[model samples]
Structure formats: structure tokens, C-alpha cells
Target: MSKRTIDYYTKIGILTPERSESNYRFYGEDSIETLHLVSQCKEQNMPLAEIKEKISLYYTSSVEKEKLLKYAQVLSKRMEHLEAELKEIKPLLDALNEEEQKSIINRMSPQSMALAQSLIILFN
Candidate 1:
């Protein structure tokens, strides 16, 4: 990793560096692993504040891997839930009888129709 990235993490208190007699910042093996983790979290687009908390937890206990895994699983479940809900909407729309569908279309004003179309585009 670049020196700038390491410096940033240190500045933000996510990683602490040891100081030599000359006052040069130095990192141990654990700090190296922490930097690797910070990189991984950034790749997944986690917020810096949240990454700091995760790393803090990693340092505090023996269940570091489990904590990270739980975060990943929660995110995975949310995506799955949203996908299922979106999929269900399609079948519900399809199941509406022709008359029901036409009635909804007929009742919708031009502005409402446009809004509905926009909403569909946004979600899809």
C-alpha cells in the first residue's frame, strides 16, 4: 500500500503506528494485516467511520473473522430480500385481470402514468 493511505488511516485513528527513537512511524505485523483489512473494506465501499469500528472490534477480541462475516451476511440478506420483493411485484402485476389492469390505466392521469413509469425505471 502507498504511504499516503497508511498515513490517512493513522490520522483517522484506525491504525496506530509505533515510533522509533528518530520519531519515524513504524508498523508491526498486526498493523500490516489491519491495512490489508482496510483495503478490503474500502473495495466493498464501506464508509470510513464504519470501517474504523470494524477494525476496532477486530483488535478487541478473538472473533474478528466472525464479526466481518456477520456484516457481510447481513448485507447479503438485504440484497436478497430486496430482489425477492421486486420479483414478487412483477407476478402480482401480471396476475391482475385484464379488466383490473385496464381500469388502473384508465384511472391514472397522464402525470400519474409518467410518475409510475419513472418509478418503474428507477427500481429496475
Candidate 2:
């Protein structure tokens, strides 16, 4: 928990802390948990390299799950926004003649067309 210990851990790649523009390092919840893990590992006389490997394994799964959850949240928000836009535009689209709708669809980029189709399929 001491600054020197943190410095050593950072130097050895065991603990990574965010640094400010002025170079002050900041530790958060993750760092606190890592420090506790390191202390426990050291108590059992684990080598630094081994402890680092263990922490890397821990972070790999944890970070992947965090990234996936964040992605799902962003995707959910995007889907909600898309639904709202579609609702607002539905009346206008319906008023268009078949040829006009075809013209609009033709003007869309292939990727956009594909995404629209995908969204339609998803909603149905």
C-alpha cells in the first residue's frame, strides 16, 4: 500500500496506474484489488513473475467481460435510437409512392442498405 511498493509493482508490470498530464500516478479500485492479491501472493512466497502471470490471466477474462458488457450497452442504446427514428419516419415513408421508396433505397449506400435490412429482420 506504500508508494514505494506501488512504484516497484508498476516497474515490474504487476500494477499499472493511470498518470496525469503532470505525471502524478492515480490508483483506482482495480489497483487496490491487485495490491491485495500481490500481498497475498507475497505472503505465500510467490515469485514476482508468477504473480504477474496470474494477474494477467485475471485481467484477460475480467477485461473481456467488461468490454463485452460495454459493447452490449452501446448496441442497446443504438438500437433504441434506431427504433425511435424509424417510428418518426414511418408516416413519411408510408406516404411515399413505391417508386419514391425505391428511389430512396437506391440512393442508400450498400452498407446502409444492408444495415437497414438487418434491422428489419431483427425487428420481425
TM-score of each: 0.52, 0.47
Model 2 C-alpha lDDT per residue in residues 1-124, reported as the tens digit of each score: 7888889999999999998999998989999999999998787566787688767767885566655566567558767777777767878988999999999999988877897778767775
RMSD of 1: 12.5
Q: What lDDT is reached at residue 118 by model 1?
A: 59
Candidate 1, residue 62: Cα displacement in angstroms equals 8.5
Using TM-score, give the best candidate's number. 1
Error of 1 at 100 (Å): 35
Give each prediction's root-mean-square deviation over alpha carbons. Answer: 12.5, 15.9
lDDT of 1 by residue, 1-124 (tens): 8889888889999989999999998999989899899888887677898788778777885667777787778677745665666567777878999998888789978876775665566668
Worst 10 residues of 1 by lDDT: 78-87
Worst 10 residues of 2 by lDDT: 66-75
